[model samples]
Target: MKVLIVEDEKPAARRLHRMLEQLELPVEHTVHSVKEAVEHLSNNTPPDLIFLDIQLSDGLSFEIFDHVKVDSAIIFTTAYDEYALKAFKLNSIDYLLKPIDVKELEVAVNQFKASFRESGNPIHNKAQFQPIDLQQIAKLLNEPQNAYKNRFTVKVGEHIKLFATDEIQLFYSENKGTYINLPNGRNYLLDLNLEAVEARLNPKTFFRVSRQAIVHINAITDIISYTNSRLKVKINSFTTFDLVVSRERVKDFRRWIEG
Candidate 1:
């Protein structure tokens, strides 16, 4: 299938592109902002599907609809609250939260294919797709943001453990399990996966440095240059494994660390 990605964050865009490639669905193009997306849509043939981010660098991605007519099927990629996603759910539109899981992405793709087949639309026939109410979606997503998580609860061999977000130095996935590392050098396995854990944490405080790990701003002690344009981040009391920021994330990581 022909695919396009409209995402502001370079790392996120690249990650999504990689995931699509893994699914054997090669993306045809990628645009970073609403302006670029509008221009691309006006100038080139629209793809069969678009993996679109809600917020772009210039504005909400919905603005692109004002300038161009898009007929491609869309799957939203967003960090917005579930309440704000009512428009999508009501419309039978699909969405993937930030730190999207590959399995979930696959399910979404399969659903899209099934819908396409049911509609009997040819590969180049995008006009058969229904139009979406972009204004309504924008209004819903513009509502007040959801509260960030302040603490987490985990089960430890029949015992329960609760820890505040401030106590966390880092969260990492290992052997398909997610664990939180504390400043006291203690580790607790969380019930939620890294994607779910990341969705709850405040983006201003915690940044996902790589696919495997998320680090809190308060936990950072040193930023060292690493091989192949990546970065090595040192977290307080967490030394069991090295935390290397992915090359795709280095630019954003620098911006996050600066703040």
Candidate 2:
């Protein structure tokens, strides 16, 4: 299968190229920076698959998607752990944590071949490929080494107000936008998406109970057992929707609350 490698480090890129060569997969091209990668994809036909690195020289490789539409499937090779889980949720073949292992690369390649064989036409199934959410990636990568956002600024009509993170009870998404609720019964729209906002907040103080809500530890006044072995969380503020811990996140939610 035709493949392209977009990696910034020369030795790493060359090593990956050699690995693919050993496997006898046709390596179409190898580009270093996001700019060159974008330029190549703009002029040439997209490869069947791309072995992409998350952080490139100019910017994160996700920027290439912003410039052009790519039909190729992707296997992200990166040293960063934060975005690896999120990257797999996209139409990615696999995420290979770096200092690439030969066996892991082989397995990822086999997975791709299996999917490609099943799909019959890789290019036609491009609709399933979701572009990497760069905003969320940026938030994750820029997480504070020793600090989190202590306060946030929100615009209210004609004025901007600042609220300490401790003052906020919960952050939730509704009508495609994120909003934060306060103890004083005030709600303000936030500029960042729920995922981005969650990444910035201190995980110890806040827990993402569901895709729709990130609740502060102080906000949860009650946790009632709910249907399907899920949990119904009651916050200080009255919410129109039931704040339920999603089934998948239930275990972690329990650990967070108990701790």
Candidate 3:
């Protein structure tokens, strides 16, 4: 299969490429931004399948469709909330949430093969696939009232403990494991990764200061200037680690904190 991947993060693109390689499906082309993807699609033959990310470095990947007509099948790889991705499900499109699972990736690829490959040529067959409504999806994403998690449950030996969003100071990932830091300096291990936690928490209340940590707005006691143009966040009680805002996210972080 001629596969193309359009993802902004190079590490994420590499990880997806490796996963595809493990499934014996080699990626023929990988582009980082919307501009690169549009240029490649305009010049070369459309790929049989495209692993597309919703957000790109330059702009939304939906912009690519505006620039060129694509007949290839697409499977979205996104960090968007489940509600935001519901449009894809309704449109009969498959999507893998961030920190893609290997088994799910295999299933999506197998399903694509069954649906498209079984019918002969996978490209230039508009009838076989539902036309993706990019405008409708963009509209769905812009809608307000997205449901966000207000509480989390964690196992404490023989029982489970429920912690409200207000009780948590921060969520961080370390040594390949995710943990929730509480106001009393207690830390509980979370089953989900940092990305999954970030997706569930309300963005208004929780801001991902860095890939390693997401801090509750009310929990932040101070913001200090840091090296490399990054900002360091101080949580009310969780001082186990330094919560530094990534350089790229500093501008957005400042705006979010101000509100």
- Tens-place lDDT digits, model 1, residues 79-165: 655577677788666788765767889998887778777884423233433355768778776654644666676656545566888
Query: lDDT of candidate 1?
Result: 0.79
Candidate 1 lowest-lDDT run of ten? 121-130
Q: Assess every candidate by TM-score.
A: 0.58, 0.51, 0.66
Query: Can you list the residue pairs that collide in candidate 3?
Result: none
Give stretches of model 3 more than 4 Å off: 115-117, 123-131, 147-214, 221-233, 236-259
Q: Which stretches of candidate 2 lie over 4 Å from their true place?
A: 82-93, 123-126, 146-259
- After superposition, which runs of candidate 1 have C-alpha atoms over 4 Å from their true positions? 118-132, 145-259
Could you say which candidate leads in lDDT? 3
lDDT per residue for candidate 2 within 175-254, as digits (tens), equals 86678998877788764557657756898889998889999998889999999999999987656589999999999988
Weakest ten-residue segment in model 3 by summed lDDT: 121-130
TM value for model 3? 0.66
lDDT per residue for candidate 3 within 17-56, as digits (tens), equals 9989998889999998899999999999989999988867
Q: In candidate 2, what residue range of length 10 has the lowest lDDT sum?
A: 84-93
Arrange candidates by lDDT, highest first: which order? 3, 1, 2
